[model samples]
Target: MDLTVIWAFIIAFAVFAYVVMDGFDLGIGVLFPTFAVGPERDRAMNSIAPVWDGNETWLVLGGGGLFAAFPLAYAVILPATYPLIIAMLLGLVFRGVAFEYRWRDPGHRRAWDFAFSAGSLVAALAQGMTLGALLQGIRVTGRAYAGSWWDWLTPYTLLVGLGTVAGYALLGAAWLVWKLDGAGQAHARRLARGAALATLALLGLVSLYNVALRPEYAERWLTAPTLWYALPVPVVTALAGLALLRALGRDTHAQPFFLALALFALGMAGIGVTIWPNVVPPSLTIWQAAAPHRSQVFMLVGVALTLPLILAYTAWSYWVFRGKVGGDGYH
Candidate 1:
């Protein structure tokens, strides 16, 4: 296989990892007010506090991989999706500020908490919108974006944005089930059940819409050999969702969360396969968007060394903070 293709896969995997890992935590932040209040909220925050920073490392690596290995794709995508990118960054900034300020100032803590939730909502929504727009393909005339700003913010994009929020909420709820106990656990389970149902419905709707818009996708589904191969993803996702539901019903916490992550991974894998070799769906193929060989080679050297270190530190950080948050005070 080509080195560019290998780098592309690595980068895609990194981004998907970030989404699956950090996505649930962002969902937790967004849904904080619904299931938690005061100290419970603090505990909820504490549950993710130990490893949240490390989880974001994948995003840096993913973005850097794009800039280094596929500079042209980066240039095109960043300019076209500038607004959504800015929104995502701003949300991250607000979330970080809220995370710090809520713990420091007793009186204005509520304000900061609100900021955190709002930020998470904004960032998640923006990301989903970007994904939808990318799948729909940009109007690229030569090297420039030809689409209007309004074109980027369509009804389909908005629906996808909401779907992403629901997906994250499901993830967060599953996390909470594993981390909390008694009332918190019960609450999380309820949220998880509801979120799972909603996510499934939204995913179904999106899949239908995607196939309707691109009839080729339906053809892909109809073809026996291809459909048989593709069936594993949705099949696995459905099985995971069922397992999560059963685990939640049985009050089996840990397995449900793990299964929830598996369901997310399966969904991501399906989409990745659907859009293979197209970093900017429909418009730019991976080979067309890749940077020069020399540039990619140089970037690979740095990634080869640093990626493992990042993964190790991330794993170690999570290991260190493995236990429940409880009333042990903030770290």
Candidate 2:
């Protein structure tokens, strides 16, 4: 594979991983209000605490990779999606602050907990909006944003935004099932089942709408043999969704969450492949937007070493934090 192509795939994969991992924590935050009081919420928070910050490493890597490897695309996309980007950052800020303050201020823990949950909801919504806007394609004229802010908030984009929220919520519920036991696990399983159904409906709607609105995408999928191969992603994802439902019904926690993550991974991979060669989609192809070869080479060397370290540390942290959370305790 060409160097630029390799970097593109690596960066895309990293972003997808971040979405699948950190996404659940954010979803947990969004779902906090529903779970209510005491050990349950604390367990939910604790389940993600050890690795939440580390999960963001991939976001940084993905963004940095785009900046380094595809400067033009970054310039175009950042300018086009500045509002949503700012919203996402603000949500992250709220979440981080809430994470620290909720633990320290016993007096106002309830308020902080709500803040954390709200932050998560806001962040997930913003991310979904951003994804929707990107998929809808930015209006670029000679490398400049040629559209108004309202252009990013179309009906299709709104559908995708809500779809992503449901998707992340499902992931979060799946996570809770695995991380907590007894009442918490049961509650989480119910939440997961509900979220999964909503996600399935939203996914179907978004897929149908996008195909009709952007017929080119449908053509690509139908015409290209390689793209046809990517169809199994959705197929397998649906099967996994069914399996998760079955497992939830049987009160099987561990396997359901793993299967849910697989479903997410497969969907992400399908999109990545569908949009391959086009980092910014519709307009800027990776090679067309890529920075100088020397810059990409230099960045690759550092990324090669650091990425593994990040992965290892993340895995180790999860391993250490593995098992049940209880009684609003800190260790």
Backbone N/Cα/C clashes per model: 0, 0
| Candidate 1: tens digits of C-alpha lDDT, residues 1-331 | 5888889888988988898788988989878889556777877888888877678888888888888888877877887788999999999889988988898997998899999999999999998898888776777777666777666687778878888999989888888888877677788889999998888888777766766656556666557777887778777878887887788799586787788778777877777756776888666888988888888888888888988898788788877777556665343
lDDT of 2 by residue, 66-139 (tens): 88888888888888788889988999999999999987998999989888988888889888888888887877
Error of 2 at 149 (Å): 2.3
* lDDT (0 to 1) per candidate: 0.81, 0.82
The model with the greatest lDDT is: 2
Write down the RMSD of all candidates, one decimal each. 1.6, 1.7
> Scored by Cα lDDT, where does model 1 land?
0.81
Q: lDDT score, residue 279, model 2?
A: 72
